[model samples]
Target: GAGVSQSPSNKVTEKGKDVELRCDPISGHTALYWYRQRLGQGLEFLIYFQGNSAPDKSGLPSDRFSAERTGESVSTLTIQRTQQEDSAVYLCASSPHGSLTDTQYFGPGTRLTVL
Candidate 1:
């Protein structure tokens, strides 16, 4: 129905607080990915879920970050005990092939600020 959309466009939390970011991808899309971008830095892949395959979470920086996508639809990124270094924009995208095949769509990211 709609393109990729993320909730809580911005967030502010204490250093040890937990945060959950949600993403709603386009209908029928089989590939979903999560990324993080620090201020002025480029996007870094965090996790990917494609079809029925196990999610590729090798890109996740640490055990504190995790994500899950159910049947190629909604996905959620969770950060536990947030740290200042975790402050950045969390992005979600979906594509038919799961690789930058020209059909990938990126959502407006959720900005996280830790104090």
Candidate 2:
């Protein structure tokens, strides 16, 4: 796909397990962000990164949740010891640059289910 894309639109995992989801942003976009939406809830920020700098992890629910960005390219979000409460849609978005929120484009999202 030419736009941002995500793998395994749905995932099911047992509690205490770890899961890794992938994202591919638009070509040449340098800014990437991760967010999650609990069932019937608003989007909660998780992490955002500009190029190779350490991402802003303030929005991460816990140390169990972490992400990394490589250059201005791909990213991965890993959830360790996943819990039922962690079940949600993991969305990846990208913009042209990191100076500001410049119309972030989102993928279909990966639905992580912690049973």
Query: Model 2, range 19-111, lDDT digits (tens) per residue?
Result: 999999998888898999998999999999887777788999999988877778889999999999999999999888876548999999999
Evaluated against the true structure, the overall lDDT of model 2 is: 0.90
Clashes of 1: 0
Writing each residue's lDDT as its tens digit, candidate 1 over 41-86 gives 9999999899999999999999999898778789999999999999
Alpha carbon deviation, residue 61, candidate 1 (Å): 0.6
Error of 1 at 56 (Å): 0.5
lDDT of 1 at 30: 90
TM-score for every candidate vs. truth?
0.94, 0.94
- Minimal lDDT window, size 10, model 1: 95-104
Q: What are the Cα lDDT values of the candidates?
A: 0.92, 0.90
Clashing pairs in 1: none
